[model samples]
Target chain A: MRLPKLFKRKASGEVAKDRLKILLISDRVNCSPEMLDLIKQDIARVISRYMMIDTENMEIQISKTGGYGIGSKNPSLYANIPILDLHKSS
Target chain B: MGEVIVITSGKGGVGKTTTTANVGTGLAAAGKKVVLIDTDIGLRNLDVVMGLENRIVYNLVDVVEGGCRVKQALIRDKRYPGLYLLPSAQTRDKSAVNESQMRKLVDQLREQFDYILLDCPAGIEQGFKNAIAGADRAIVVTTPEVSAIRDADRIIGLLEANSFQQIDLCINRMRYDMVKRGDMMTVEDVVDILSVNLLGVIPDDESVVVSTNQGEPLVGNHTLAGRAYRNVCMRLMGQDVPYMDLERSLSFWTRVTGIFHKSQEGRA
Candidate 1:
């Protein structure tokens, strides 16, 4: 007997975009959720290190992306870093 | 001393037993004295998967409970010279053994085998805890699905909490055709989400079902996914083999373009 086709339907042009943001709590220092937050925060912190502060209205966010491996050119990370300084002494 | 590696995942049916059987057979075929310990008590499938269920005279719990020595409980795999299996007790509860008890059991076996692969049970409960207690390292298995990844992430968190020195990931049952069609997540997505060293990726194949039904691992025979598992064993042995292309088929456009270019060259 012939096996029925597996995933033989017509392919579409649209692709799913996975939007994943893992929150970083101080105590949760490991796992995927923590790692995504670390990647985002490090980018924001790197930018903040070289610039002046406007902490009151500062916000940063990163959605998990998978088009490229973490070690290579991650244009998304570079694009998503918050441009404003996010540190304050208050 | 022989090393102990636990094949564990936080979710069920994510290919933990499959990994254990294949890795055990692969290592054994490579001339290492390998023993697979099925620690999934009350849900024993490793013996069945390995086709050693009918030959079981003693089990893991029996050794732990002092009913028999570890040697007496180990069943040798006939296909490979050095492969053995310490089957789990299907009738026992996970709570019957504690973490330290498992640690002692694996430690004793460590002196006798080149690699001891533990087939951990599902869930982050007593079975999971007991399975990891005796192992030196861990191999976390996950499917490309979100639920399996969520569970694997939790398992990785637990292992890190316990200070496991080495932990790796294996994304199994991956269907690259689905991934190309955007129907399933790619291995890259899984690696990015987990952020762990990838041991390897096993393509989803009907051969796996056939082999499991036959009570034999794909790695013990010739199959595409079986070769992937064989590569994984090599990687585990510190060989730097490149990962194979997970895509089952190039998009039709890609093949069409290749043919189009070739015919143009022929015209020239």
Candidate 2:
């Protein structure tokens, strides 16, 4: 039973962690992964009307942030939209 | 004054009531005046779990609604001298009692008992709100499942938002054999995800069912789960008790191999 590190077995820790991270985000936003994808699509479409954005590289997540000057915190939606180009006509 | 602690789990059937009953009985066994309040209301089961269902003459709603005195509603445990039970009314619903009334009742009981353990109902609803309203501390119970952990996280957030201090976690129904086999979530995995002070891990034991049927908390019982609950009670009493060595049966080589394999899989 004494095996070396070269032949390690897969434990459930990583699986639990990965699932919890994504699930906690979705739970905070009250949205499923598919719903989040749709929301991201909608955001990208709406923003692309004014600017050329890279939807593939866009990142949307829920993060826990501290309330301003207070000892409390809240979950806020953070969206990182990469702008490839802006509309010159406007 | 006694400390009021609420045992809560957003997901149902995660051993909240069991924890409340056991912890209360454990504290009482330690000679501390303890009262377990079942706040589940219409869905009350703490009475049955504690085997004090037949002795329930007055309930929590009766005290809150001015139908009876708090002492009249309190049921003393037959086994534990200092233990008591404030059963919830099965006829009434959660809406029957509000936050302020619960606070007042708990405040009165605080002057009398050494610990008031509130057995919270499942879900983040009115019942949950009322259960936590009177608590000075919180014990969020959850199983190793993803859904249960997520709910526990949400409940922790709610507790923090409501200014609850000293929040702790208890992983219930933990299978030590599965953990040793690396199939189930380990205690470290849960602690890392939830990021709360670990209370205790109750190993899955068959004696729990029998003890529940017998209407007694597992303090004096020689079951694995009973010992775990006793450890939790000691820790709650501010003792520097080390966690039970659940991996005593596992060989060193097996653990090392399991970790090595887990890390290899992670990289892959």
Candidate 3:
């Protein structure tokens, strides 16, 4: 919901929300968004060499995975790339 | 058994020390024997905030190093019968006291007082780690500003990772005027973001500055901030106290809008 603009400037609340979104995400991953994007691009590039993949529909995320041992729950990079026609493009 | 609570914020200048002083004093005033521990080490100020700075013959480092007994280091507050201060050593850094020493100190304090309040240092460093090491619960203090809230979120995560169960939030230095104008985050907005149990909200009051400067906790005074701290103390003791009426500072336009809506509802 938008409030009536009492003053002629962007609301501080809105500005805060925008900054917090990016900051919290980066803080969790311990990396910048640009770095995350670069990682995703590199993953896509490596996988496309051996398979005809639908890059537009691919999803890649780096997050902590659950495991049941000492220091076992390491961060894992998961990529779900749809193979449109595997080994057909090469 | 006594309870130990750590008051911490990831960012500095957010009034963790003030909250500790007021709440410790308020709890003591309610007849609960309480000891306030300053674990900020080199940056210790809870003693100054409680106005017990001059009484520090021994500090946390002394107790940890076996230089003095814990009782010897505890400076009793003459104003409140049950209140005491375990001031941190201004000469020592955060490295002087480790997590185990903090736990040992808190365990000893628990054997005496009914409440042990640890005033944590800012930042997610060794001091913060040591403060939460001995805490059974935590109070995350944050102002209504973005930087404070962001840091509070990080502190909450760290507390949870350390297996802290009861982490309550206190929104400090909130300006009702700014919230009404939609220029600042409201209490609800903060609660929604942090997703924690609300302990209390301390309105921005100039009396807080005067009280702090005078080395007096503002819990027992008739001022708005004092009343807020009193309510917080009651809430800590399992009492369901209603929040103070911050709406009294609402703008005229908001009241007018409310009246128009109410009139339309009556007609319908």
Fraction of native A-B contacts kept, per candidate: 0.05, 0.45, 0.31
Cα-based lDDT at residue B56, candidate 2 = 90
* Candidate 2 TM-score restricted to chain A: 0.63
Count of residue pairs whose backbone atoms collide, per candidate:
0, 4, 0
- Candidate 1, CAPRI quality class derived from DockQ: incorrect
Q: Where in model 2 is the C-alpha error above 4 Å? A: A1-13, A29-60, A63-90, B249-268
Query: Each model's TM-score?
Result: 0.75, 0.80, 0.80
Pairs of residues at least 3 apart in sequence or in different chains that clash in candidate 2? A8-B260, A8-B261, A9-B261, A9-B262
Model 3 TM-score on a 0 to 1 scale: 0.80
lDDT of each: 0.77, 0.84, 0.84
> Which tens-of-lDDT digit does each residue in B1-268 have in candidate 2?
9999999999999999999988988888888999999999899999988999999999999999899998898998888779899999999898999999999999999999899999999999999999999899999999988889999989988887898868899999898787766668889888876777898999887879988898877763445677788889999999988887777624676457546654654311
Clashing pairs in 3: none
Candidate 3 lDDT over residue span B54-73, tens digit each? 88899999999999898899
| 1 versus 3: better DockQ goes to | 3
Q: Output per-candidate TM-scores for chain A, rounded to 2 decimals.
A: 0.30, 0.63, 0.60
